[model samples]
Target: MTDLALLQALGALCVEAGRAILDVYDAEAIVVRSKDDRSPVTDADERAEEILHAVLAKLFPGVTVIAEEAASRDGAPTEAPETFLLVDPLDGTREFINRNGEFTVNVGLISRRAPVLGCVHAPALGATWIGAAGRGAFKAEAAIRDVPAPAAYRPIAVRQRPAAGLCAVASRSHADAETEAFLEKLGVVERRSAGSSLKFCLVAEAAADVYPRFGPTMEWDTAAGHAVLAAAGGAVTRPDMTPFDYGKAEAGFRNGGFVAWGARD
Candidate 1:
């Protein structure tokens, strides 16, 4: 499939994944477990990841994947192949457990160490952001999926506001005093709370702008959304405002503090 088509196709996978997550999410007596880092995990995360990997492998045969649930369960992929899939099946386990409905399914395509195409779907919230390099970002409401095989496709762009009142995107569960102190310096309008990498989607779509994440995030966390926001005319810069550098050998699939904004420099 063409890269643009690949993005939309993956978008369909995201929708399916979202439905599975919601199915488990709505079930009675859901159980939550703690990983070694004390972060929460749930059956939904595992089941969604399993389905996603199966679908992705079929779609792109021979493409490896760095899936969170699989890595968490079977241990990290022994080798990081040059080209592979990056999946975060369930982005907001805390929000899922809290039943706040901000969780998401993130699927990213990283080509030659750069985010090329991606999709983020929040089923319960009925929102999705899909993008591809050289093709601008778009949002689709889940409710419109049945109308003539889908109809609500609107182009999305970053807010071109001057740096006066920035909308600060933040984590729903990982909020810390340090990040709060950092927000104070940005002339934030207010905290826009979202679970998982959906914070990046908010900035990508200009629905909200400027997400400064100081906490730990792996490469998979940002790559997909990074592509979306970058394609939408946004910037993903280091804390000091340098453009972000991914696929560095030393970083080993890890990411550092970076600001994602819809408008670029």
Candidate 2:
């Protein structure tokens, strides 16, 4: 399949997974559990993951898929292949538990240690963001199980850094002093707190100028949003401004501190 076609497939998959998540989210009771790592999980997470895994296995047979719930249950691989997928079935379980409209379903493709394609779908918000290496980036109002038409998707790009000072988006659940200090150093004139990968989409769509993440994150947590931001003319790098690549099987796919910038000077 072409890159654009692949991107569209991923987006559609996310939307399908998002539908499963919303079904659980709208239930009368949402049962929350804790992973071995102590992070929250719910029925929404598992159901969405099941949908993604089954669809991915059929859609792209033989490609390795490292998903969050499965990795937490079964140990992660010590190394990754040249090409693979990272999935966060239900990002921001806390937001879902809180009945907030900030959770998302994320799927990202990593090739040669770089995020080449991704899709993030926020079912509660009825929005989806997609990006690929050569296809640019776009946002659409995706409904449950119904992928938006090509014309329905609007191309999006990062905005040039504003001279007035940067507008920064930070993690709402995992705030830290390090992130605050970094934003302070950046002279952030405006601040927004968001849950899940939406912070990256904020920068990707020019709603914010940057996102600095000092708290711990996994590859699945950031990869899809990273692809979107990168395709929208942005960058994600270490706090020291080094290159940020994926397939860190040595680190159990855990992410280090990184900053995502829109258009930079």
Candidate 3:
């Protein structure tokens, strides 16, 4: 399928996953459990992932599917494929458990080791962002059951660096001293906290200027948002300024320190 069509399909799937997540989010209490890694998991995370996996398997029969929950259960894919779909069905499980609205459902299509199209849905916030390479990016208010319509989304792009200084965003749950030092060294004028991949979307849409992540993150944690940021004329790079590539099986699918930039810097 074409990249734009793939993004649209993925966006729909994200909305569906988001709806399932909201059902759990709006209920009385979210039952939480720990995975083998000791990270929290909930019914919402597993259910959303199940839904995504079903639809993806049906939609693209041959494409390799790598998902967070599945990886935790089954282990990382031993070999990287040239193209694959990565799903973090419910990112920010901690934020979701805390009843914060910062979590998201992330769907990313990786081609040739790069994210070519992506959709990020913040179900609780009623917003979704979609982007494809060379197609730019957009954000729109979408309900749980609603499918994405073109007119509902407004085109978005990263903004030029403000004369004042850079506005930075960091993981609400993962922020550490090293991240603070990185921001400080970057000469940040303002620092904000957000959960999940929304921090990347902030820079993607120019809501923030940069997001420096010094802690651990899996490829699924960042690919969808990375695609959106890249399409919006932003960049995600390693500390040495190299491009960030996906499907890193040797690294156990974990990412090293990276900085997402809205400005050219």
**lDDT (C-alpha, whole model) for all candidates:** 0.78, 0.91, 0.90
N/CA/C clash count, model 1: 0
| Candidate 1 lDDT by residue in tens digits, 167-195 | 78888878888788888987787678888
Q: Per-residue alpha-carbon lDDT of model 2 for 154-221, expressed as tens digits?
A: 99999998989999999889888888888888899999999999999999999999999987899999
| Winner by lDDT between candidate 3 and candidate 1 | 3
Q: Root-mean-square deviation of each candidate, in angstroms?
A: 2.4, 1.2, 1.4
Instruction: Give the least accurate 10-residue stretch of model 1, judged by summed lDDT.
Output: 144-153
**Model 2, 99: alpha-carbon shift in Å?**
0.9
Residue clash pairs of candidate 3: none
Sorted on lDDT, highest at the top, how do the candidates line up?
2, 3, 1
Clashes of each: 0, 0, 0
The candidates, ranked best first by TM-score, are 2, 3, 1
Q: How far off is residue 121 in model 2, in Å?
A: 0.4
Off by more than 4 A, model 2: 143-145
lDDT of 1 at 137: 85
User: What lDDT, from 0 to 1, does candidate 1 have?
Assistant: 0.78
